[model samples]
Target: MTKTNNIEKAYDFGASEFNRKMKRITQERLKRGLPVSLDIPNDATPEELEELKAFDAWTRDGQPVED
Candidate 1:
């Protein structure tokens, strides 16, 4: 008998699509001058912060994060 790791399987299927949707929503909020709240932990890394800053700049300039 084999056991399935449902959570891992779900993540594998949806992670990329979920990230894309979230990025789009974030950019739209930035364009509208609305707050963008993330679930980042307090111990987030510097790289994460830098990426977020870059995304903010791109969205402010009417650019999408993925492009």
Candidate 2:
């Protein structure tokens, strides 16, 4: 499987963990809107890229992709 596929599967397998992390992120964002967006590092892995892509696509519809 591709790295993106694997990461997507792992995300499904770890749904609870994902929810917890997102909840924390949302609460933090609500409490303190950032003045500047943080940049992702240059050497990020394929999986990291896929995660960000999935977040962007999914958050709008409140849906998770099927693994």
Model 2: how far residue 40 lies from native, Å:
3.1
User: Against the true structure, whose lDDT is highest?
Assistant: 1
Please write out the lDDT profile of model 1 over residues 1-67, one tens digit for every residue.
Answer: 1114542211221135665666688778877889977556688787666555554444345544453
Model 2 misplacement above 4 A: 1-39, 62-67
Off by over 4 Å in 1: 1-15, 42-67
lDDT of 2 by residue, 37-60 (tens): 334669988777766655533333
Clash pairs detected, candidate 1: none
- The lDDT for every candidate, in the order shown, is 0.53, 0.48
As a whole number from 0 to 100, the lDDT of residue 52 in candidate 1 is 55
Clashes (backbone N, CA, C under 3 Å), per candidate, total: 0, 0
Error of 2 at 54 (Å): 0.7
